[model samples]
Target: MDMATTTSTATHTSLASVTLEVADPEAARRFYGAFGVDTYIRLRASETHSTGFRGFTLALTVSGPATVDGFVAAAVDAGAAVLKPATKSLWGYGGVVQAPDGTIWKIATSAKKDTGPATREIDEVVLLLGVEDVKATKQFYVSRGLSVAKSFGGKYAEFTPGQSSPVKLALYKRHALAKDLGVPADGTGSHRIALGSTAGSFTDPDGFTWEAAAPPAPTPS
Candidate 1:
């Protein structure tokens, strides 16, 4: 079944904001605030019957191991459950955490060592949707006028965001994403998330919805 009734198709979409549907908006707001990511996403109340992996994750690409560790620590202190501890791997240092509201987040970096003092600075925030078929989903977004910035055959694809976009969009195989996040692959019901953009609203092939909305106002530094 479709997650929600989508209204229109997306065109020239750049991910301006992401909204997470939570059961407790106030609690979520508190958690995100303590975790230092409240400014990156919005929240709404919904008792959506979502379970297991939601087929997506918000990935934080930061500077180095220290930064990754710093974010992971903050999330844990903010009431997030750690799915994986920050550690160095073939890719780099990173970890996974499930927010109090059931959203999964992966904090990672390509640099294995600390370059300077740790800070709450995010280099890039990518919204990765786990899809059944990477190629088909990539084509769907392409038809919607989202330009492809990176493609790895059937394994993954990423879209180029407009200058004003706050988040970048990417696609990966569903099962693979779950494995990467150290979670099981099976899931059902609402994704409990929405992507906001300048483009018109539409549901993607994987049931992820994009809405017509302005980007989030820039938060004071």
Candidate 2:
């Protein structure tokens, strides 16, 4: 990878959408629909060889414990496997679920308690990529025009999303991210996700691909 390449042209790059490669788009569609996150992602049918962790996770940030539980329960009822049951933690309450299509999702919130009845509103959708090195990957993205919104040394880094981007991007150490997601760190083959961005096409240091934005489909006259 060309670590020194300047992507000044990509200074305006922002994540436009995320597409998940799955074996069955219909099945994935149903699962995501039932899980209440269908509108947040796109899906394509793929039989690419992949096993274990897949090196990443999509997280949903909600309001409180009730909301966390609400989403987790919906995921479970929708045929998602529970990697971690909803529970209170030092930082907040959350749980992990693996969609039938093999995409892992973490639903969580900073508030430990619910202030009112649970609603299925998602506050944020974050695509967290597990990288070999946080600092190096951070610099790699910076060179590609992504601005750092937050950094925690070699542990984690988050980039500001372009105004129109729906998903927030972040980086985390592979092993640590796996641990947090309650899974093994070892994996191979494709990440099975493609990112649509305004920065043109390029692959990041971690093998995550970013492509130029697709023109919006025309409406019926």
Candidate 3:
């Protein structure tokens, strides 16, 4: 759900697109694109990453409570099912929605009360995976070039974003993740979120997918 960063020559993990497989790519784009930044919609499907999540959620950090409400209302209007209505949450004002594509979306603001219009409506997209072994999962990423900005024993861990990362990647212990989503921790198999890298295609300890991609082209001088 968060990250810890540092200087390292071999921090090989680059922040990549957290690709979601949907029946209709256009529809997914229209919906999620509004709530997330730099959302890349792919028509090509990955057999492994296409399976919907049994234990995960994508979170968007908004600027304030008012923006949180506004976005949730739009999601509900577009036929998303409300899992939790906008309200003051333990972590400030927040709400949840189940997208038509069967992905869980959460909108939250760090401020508890209305803070007016958001300067940036969609701040970040966090790929929160529910893992059976957080420590093992954390190590798997580290070996593949991910750097940890912060970690806690074996319950949770966060990865620092490499250049070009569009979304944040994180791991949480299974039951704890379930608690965060108000669901059961009895999920296994495909997580339906793909972490892409120029590094190549492979699967993580929890079976979440990551694909091969070239590093982003640098901006002109």
Best candidate, TM-score-wise? 2
Please give, for residues 75-118, the per-residue lDDT of candidate 1 as tens digits.
Answer: 99989999999999998899999999999999999998888999
Best-to-worst ranking by TM-score:
2, 1, 3
Output the TM-score of candidate 2. Answer: 0.92
Stronger candidate by TM-score (1 vs 2):
2
- Lowest lDDT sum, 10 consecutive residues, model 3, at 37-46
lDDT of 3: 0.70
lDDT of each: 0.87, 0.88, 0.70
Candidate 3 C-alpha error for residue 76, in Å: 1.0
Question: For every model shown, what is its TM-score relative to the native structure?
Answer: 0.91, 0.92, 0.82
Model 2: per-residue Cα lDDT over 2-111, one tens digit each: 23222234456677889899999988888898899977788888999988999999999999999999999999998999999999999999999999988999999999
Cα miss at 20, model 3 (Å)? 0.5
